[model samples]
Target: MSTQTSRLSPEKVWLGITPTLWWNDDFINIDIGIPFEQCISEMALAGYVGCSVGHKYPTDRKTLKAALDLRGLRVSEPWVSTYFTIAAMRKQTIQKVRQQLAFLQEMEGGSEDPRKADLVVAEFGHAVNPLPVALFPNCPNLTDGQWDQLLDGLHDIGRIAKEEGRRLCYHPHLGTGVMAAEAIDRLMENTETSLVHLLLDTGHLAAAGVDPLAVTKRYASRIKHIHLKDIRADVVARIHADGLSFESAIEAGIFTVPGDGSITTFPQILTELAEVGFAGWLVIEAEQAPAKANPLQYAKMARAYLRETLGW
Candidate 1:
């Protein structure tokens, strides 16, 4: 990782990590699943104050909150897949957004100093990440008409989030329609900044051959949330050379905690965010095989790196 230090204050952002490291949500069959108690406990033990909800998280609000509170952890955000390109899925997608927002509201500490968890949305329609095809070749190219539907659908979704006291953070992901730098730029240029904010994922951008630092500098004003991780350049090269699927690349150990891999642009990216006075959740969200990557050990590695470099 780059050795550059950030000017961003530790208090400016809520540092969190996702439980996806402990339990693979996309490929549930890749089972190295640990108990829920151990997951959150290990996160807090590793010094994260918050986390995004995972598949293993309890459905009951009170139950989930209590478990997290015991370990000084809280929900940072939850991933909500949106099928905006497909007209039939639009209504249900909005409904799902409403339900997620309600869950976040219920998870809030109290009204005294209320901090609402933002919503993470991604275009999942025609997504190929979960399939068995090569991610690079299989990622769908959006038609002009599909683009219209997606942008319009996102506007409606963003409005609802704004009404509910939450910011909508759009996640540009691998094997999805909006995974590349150009797609991300188009989304940012067209969306209502107040309603739809960006959720910059360093690992995804780096793997897609885009510089994370450039994206951060370009969209810093609209970024409301972040997913921090590093990808092994060698692994990424192999994925492309071998025509690997997203799942296959992950299984091949393409992603890892920030400082544990070859992506050395994090410090520069974080510095850019700090310079822009960005304030929100910086989540450590790298999904890897638990058996191969050791979740707790990697979490600690990430925590130590953040402390050493960013003073988090």
Candidate 2:
């Protein structure tokens, strides 16, 4: 037998873990509770190649770098989990975008920690559906004008990221303005490759009634970041029946570790990404019940599955 290994680029297969794993009652949880250094150490100890800092984690350069150095982990990406809005209120949207960019700049300047690196990803839009009722009651089905506004905001954000020597990725999440497959397509169509990049989240794509692998293949060229979130179909069904919120569903166990879910097409997804020569950080965003499951343990298992099953 030939001993040739999968020849994907090393950069393409950077495994990352989100600090959301450490969100617990003890950690002061939301974003700031978990000590920055601990976050880096935990991620590194869990076998992740990098760490993606969420909104709650410390964004200061000094703190981030110190943690990275302590844990010997790299900053895979910094996620602006919030900031984009698909509302009709142009002024509010603009304000949010400006504030987001400002935050990014602040973090960059404050990145005194070797591990607190660049803001590599900027997600735009949310998953709030039932248009005209949910978050954007005034604007159901993101109008052309609203889309233009979002695009403008992304353009500005992208400019800042580029100048700061970072990459800007747009995440199309479930229950947000760009929830459906067509909506993602539309947004991608409207966006220029140079202005923004795609953060392919498999779980959100599946939750939104789209084939995650299909969308991944379709937008393979635009994707730069990846969130490997797995979901439980039964819990998802219950959430649908009860009209429960996404956050609630997460609380109720609508998602779990990669190997513990109903998502069975992992090999295919890995194959497709490999075929397309798509290389980027593969982040394990296992949003399971914190009370029942330990995030660090689950994350470690997910990393094992990715390596064994996906050969990543």
Pairing residues by index, what is the TM-score of model 2?
A: 0.79
Candidate 2 lDDT score relative to the true structure: 0.64
Instruction: State the lDDT of candidate 1 residue by residue for 9-30, as single tens digits.
Output: 6566888999888988888866
Please state every model's RMSD to the true fold in angstroms: 1.8, 4.9
Off by over 4 Å in 2: 1-5, 9-11, 24-38, 81-140, 310-312
The TM-score obtained by model 1 is 0.96
Per-model CA lDDT versus the true structure: 0.87, 0.64
